[model samples]
Target: MRHTDVVIIGGGPAGLAAAVKLWEQGIRDILILEREHHLGGILRQCIHDGFGLTRFGETLSGPEYAQRFIDQVEKYKIPYITDVTVIGLDKEKKVTAAHKEGILEIQAKAVVLAMGCRERTRGAISIPGERPAGVYTAGVAQAYMNLQNIMVGKEVIILGSGDIGMIMARRMTLEGAHVKGVFEVQPYASGLPRNVEQCLNDYGIPLKLSHTVTDIKGRDRLESVVISQVDEKMQPVPGTEKEYPCDTLILSVGLIPENELSLMAGVKLDERTKGPEVNEKHETTVPGIFAAGNVLQVHDLVDFVSMEAEELADSVAEYIKKDEKAEAEHTQGEEAEEYMADVVTDGNVSHTVPQKISGKKDIRLCMRVRRPMKNCAIQLIQGGKVIQEKKMKKAIPAEMIQIPVKAGILKEKENLEVKVIW
Candidate 1:
């Protein structure tokens, strides 16, 4: 088996950033494996601007943002292989992948899972309709337009107010295609505030909140989609059905973290994030295995993904140094599984990542609310007592709440709860 100091799966923003950070930490012998022929991941398909606003302070396109790190990866001469599909990962940190050269197995001291996320397709959402060619995921249409130079269709009816859908509504309008309207089951826009304002409002694309595409009347290609208003239960109001004629129906329902490899490697998963359960260091329950980026939790922006990778790189360094010290001492035996207290949530809180708190260190809880709340307060409670409380102007499920709690605070009590005071 070929060996490496660290093996990073999926050479996207997460992998690239981690490699760069790890190299900066004086750690080399890193290998990044990517399934695609090129790096950059989904960023290559996103041609529109508005990226890098957080990190670079300059509004950049997705490709431009990704190139910033890709250039760094090349400048540092970090080794990475394209068109290599990682098939399996063992608990022992053995990675099995298939390449043109043949099956390759890598024994790694540390493995960073950066496979990112996948767009939820028609089947996943269970849209009632005939399987039609004109139907496409927002990401697919994005790729078709930006990378392949192909226009998907003339008229589009997008389902779901996901950021991609909102962006595509404006993108299609710019490309001379008519975006009839964007339908969302939720009352509020699911994407960012800026995306809703710029991509939809500015383009005069109608955002039909509290509405959904109940039925699609397409056979060979898309003919029309039946739209209807939904009640409080998010169920379609029967008599409110109206047909919108369109050749293309774009689905941008949601994103699911690509965590099969993590599960295969025996990493415990957070049900809410649908990703790996990580510690503050971003290390998983499996000692040498770590996760970052959308694979760990679906991040709203690429900048956050990069930040996670930077921190994760440091954690990997810490793991390596500790492992080396243990080996030298001949005390490198397997570590007994330690108890990790659950970070429970109540009220409008949907879920919290790094669900299990282990060791004593300052922790950042990345959480998402179940719904939007105005003039809300967040509380960190320990054993029915409020340890910390902070007020917020607003909190939305679409945005991740980065709550920092000081170290040694978790060990102070038996149960930790995050309650949203609305």
Candidate 2:
């Protein structure tokens, strides 16, 4: 068995950032295990130039952004195990992993989970079709086209208007494919506003909202798709059915956090985010086991992922230097609280992160709305008293909204409420 002060699973941006931060904090005994042969994770396949505007203050391709972090890891001489997959974790933060070399075990004082997320496939959506050859997830299609220089098809109809789907629509168009349109089940687009404008609108690509691809028809290759509009109940309207003939179909329904190791380690998960339940510090229910990046919540940008990783690394350093007994006592005290705030969704609200709060510290509430509204007001109320309010000229579901609460606000409140009023 090997021992280390810190063990980070997955060597993507999150893991690399955590390692760098830990190194700055004077923690040297760290190990990063990556399943792939190299680092960067999904960013390696993305060759577009829109990344790193907020983080680096410059437009960079995905690989370029990853290269910046890779340089840090190399400069610090961080030890890493590539092509090693973590299979499980125990209560004591023991990590079990396997690679070509065979099974390896590591007893780590603290573990950071940055395994990232996976794309939703056709099976998850259950689109009716002949298990055809032309269907691909947006990410897979991106890898095939951008990295492998393989053309997926000449005609495409993308299902879902998420960022990946929107981006791929433009990519296919640039590659000389005829993009029929993009269909979204939700009433509003799930992608960022700039993506929708630059990727879809600028190219005259159609976006069908409140509509879904009800059926896919093909024999060997994708031939066509039948789309229909849906009502508030999400049931298809019988008369609104329309068919579009296309050679390929791309689905970007959603992303699910890779949490098998988290489950094995007995970490509590949030039902809404479909990720691990984490506090402000990004620590899970199991002490010394932390999670960040897309594993905690699906961030819209890589900049937010880096920010989360930096904060998580600080927490790990504190855990390593502090007394174990005192840490356990503090954790137990926080868990002993009975009353907690449930941030619910109303008419226009979509979902809120950090689903449960203990009212013990200052917190930032991040959320998205269900639709676009003009001249809207966001109100934070507790026990019929307004604690915070903000006005916006326009608010859309595509962008995430963040509101920070001071510790003083929680001192007098038993219940916290968030609402959108237009």
Candidate 3:
């Protein structure tokens, strides 16, 4: 079959960034396979301005932000095939894909998993309701409105105050639709503070926390929804149902990392993040197979996704530079276990990226807290001693917390622990 030094799946932001970085490192034999007909991934549908602030120090729309990378790929003449959906991946780095022509196979020296993520739907959360036509995920609604020039509904009820949901609430309002309200099951808003303020407060859209839609009304099309307050356990409170009439119900519950191909390649998954477990180098348990972007962990920002992909690209370059036989032998049996350190977290931590570290160099640990807390400190512990600690004014589940640790303190440590205390 065809052979390449690197084969990246999904020509999204992550794959684009990784491919560019690999090319910059003098890796010429590279190919990118994208399932969609075009590049840019989710950013193509996201038309709002406010992206690229951290990455480019400027406010840009989603398409504009993605275009910068797309331009770079063109300048470098990086090869990418669109409308090609990868159907299978093996441990030996062979990729099977299907396109308009027929089945395609590639023998890759290294594979980067950049498949990104998918929006959680009504059925995923098990929202009790009759199947209605007006219900849509926030992303789907965005694509319909921005790409297809179709309005989802006149009156909208958004469930889950996710960043996308909040943004859609503002979009619907601007489009002359009356947004009933945004209901969240969590005690606190799931979206960023800026989103809640700019999207909801500025538009006068009420965000009802500790509340959820218990029942959905209407038969063929959405007519109304029953909202109810939730207790500490997030269970719906009795006799607290409030009916709000609306033509559409938009769900922004959550995002799940796309990993069906990764699983086929036998990558170990982290239950906490619902993504593949990776080391500091972003390499999965299956050697030469690496994952980045949302496929590794759900990132709060697209900038971070690109940054992580670049870092993983560096590791992939190093892998290609080494002897394949020696690298494989070194990562087997007891040597592999000794080469990596296990990372453990306290109950306060929701999850972490790079579940293991080499302890050979400094690393930036990324994680999120379980809930919001004021006056908290995140401690990096080794052998029951706090090696490093960072105090924060506040910690929230909506934001990711990154801490940089020194290698000197972690060198001899077999296990490292992370604790969030308030």
Once fitted onto the true fold, the runs of candidate 1 whose alpha carbons sit more than 4 angstroms away are 333-338
Give me the runs in candidate 2 sitting further than 4 Å from their true place: 324-348, 356-361, 382-384, 412-415
Best by lDDT: 3
TM of each candidate vs. truth: 0.96, 0.91, 0.96
C-alpha RMSD for every candidate:
1.5, 3.0, 2.3
lDDT tens string, model 1, 1-422? 99898999988889989999999998888999999999998888888887888888999988899999999999999999999999999999999999999999999999999999999988887778677779999999998998999999999999999999999999899999999999898999898988999999998999989988888887788899888999999988889999999999998899999989998999999878889988778989888999999999888988889988998999898777777788899995457666677788885788887777763777778888889999999999887788888899999878888978887666632557889987
Instruction: Kindly provide the TM-score of model 2 when superposed on the true structure, using C-alpha atoms.
Output: 0.91
- Candidate lDDT (C-alpha), each: 0.88, 0.86, 0.91
lDDT: worst 10-residue window of model 3: 329-338
* TM-score winner between candidates 2 and 3: 3
* Model 3: lDDT of residue 37: 88
lDDT of 3: 0.91
Q: Which lDDT tens digits does candidate 2 get at residues 77-153?
A: 99999999899899899999998989999999899999999999888978775777899999999999988899999
Q: Which portions of model 3 show Cα errors greater than 4 Å?
A: 324-338
**Backbone clash count for every predicted candidate, in the order shown:** 0, 0, 0
